[model samples]
Target: MSDIHKHIEESQVTLSELMLPSHANFGGKIHGGYILSLMDQIAFACSSKHSKYYCVTASVDTVNFLNPIEVGELVTLKASINYVGKTSMIVGIRVEAENIHTGVKKHCNSSYFTMVAKDDNGNGMEVPGLILDSKIEIRRFLKSASRLASKKHSKFQETNFEVEKYISELKNHNVIVDYKGYK
Candidate 1:
């Protein structure tokens, strides 16, 4: 283990479980919240493995459920370190559900979790740098960087919001803005 860095592959974590009836929601499908919990667990495990320190989830960037998970299907979550900052790492997770009888798999969701390493004293600790060894790893690292940049830009836009400028943009979407009583 290099003191300063670790390969992304070395920190990958995969978890798979058979979906049980108890995991389903009132609609009779697996609940999104349950899958998110599993994703968070794998993110913590992967980040801690890479950083060699205790870590906590800073934020979950996105959780887009592409497909619904069915009860009795096998669900798998694969997590890997996408990018690492001084004390933070982005864990990319891919979720898939498989039908056991048919051996068919469908992508359920993809999420990015940001985790920050902490020392025993609960202070932020420096984490090992990521070693990108493959194209996919490099792409993920770039994607994480781009995502962070976009988030910062969005924050700035929100802070200095202009309703007039967005009115034209909102026209293209499913929005109806009445200017008479608008803030």
Candidate 2:
């Protein structure tokens, strides 16, 4: 197969939806889960458009809810491929809510979703290389790379971490450790 390269803007996806009363929670605010579902949809669309294959969400690196979306606001989700590996792409999503009456906009959430391209047989498939055109694109790619590295290092620490040493460190927080249990 020939190598494929794509620009970051080539596969960008944007979705806008009006929040309805049915989508609101008991507090009359739009549900965060609803917004997350929308983000996942846009991420899938962006990655699939870029990779030309079905994509699955491997992991969600970060999801920061900056502001609460209210009912009757227009919510927009923008997604683009921030970074690409052989078979994986990091889809960065930004969500915003606008008050239709006053035309005020609020940043709702930001998230990064790691997606893996898959063939019809459910095997991993190669994805197109990202062509970063601007400084912002390059910065996003580098940020995603660093986030991925941090995640791996954190996993390694979690796997081989020493509980005995950790217990001592817990003294910095408000916690009482009763070491009576047998090892």
Scored by TM-score, the top model is 2
Across 1-183, the per-residue lDDT of candidate 2 in tens digits comes to 228788888999999999999999899999888998999999999999999999999999769988999999999999999999889999999999999999999998999999999999999998989888899999999999998888778733866966765566667998887776525
lDDT of 2 at 143: 95
Candidate 2 accuracy as lDDT: 0.91
RMSD of 1: 2.6
Question: How far out, in Å, is residue 98 in model 1?
Answer: 1.7
TM-score for candidate 2, please give it: 0.92
Give per-residue lDDT, candidate 1, residue 111: 91
User: Model 1, residue 18: displacement in angstroms?
Assistant: 1.1
Question: What TM-score against the true fold does each predicted structure earn?
Answer: 0.88, 0.92
Q: Across residues 27-132, which tens digit of lDDT does each residue of candidate 1 receive? A: 9999999999999999999999999899999999878989999999999999999998889999999999999999999999999999999999999988888778
lDDT of each: 0.91, 0.91
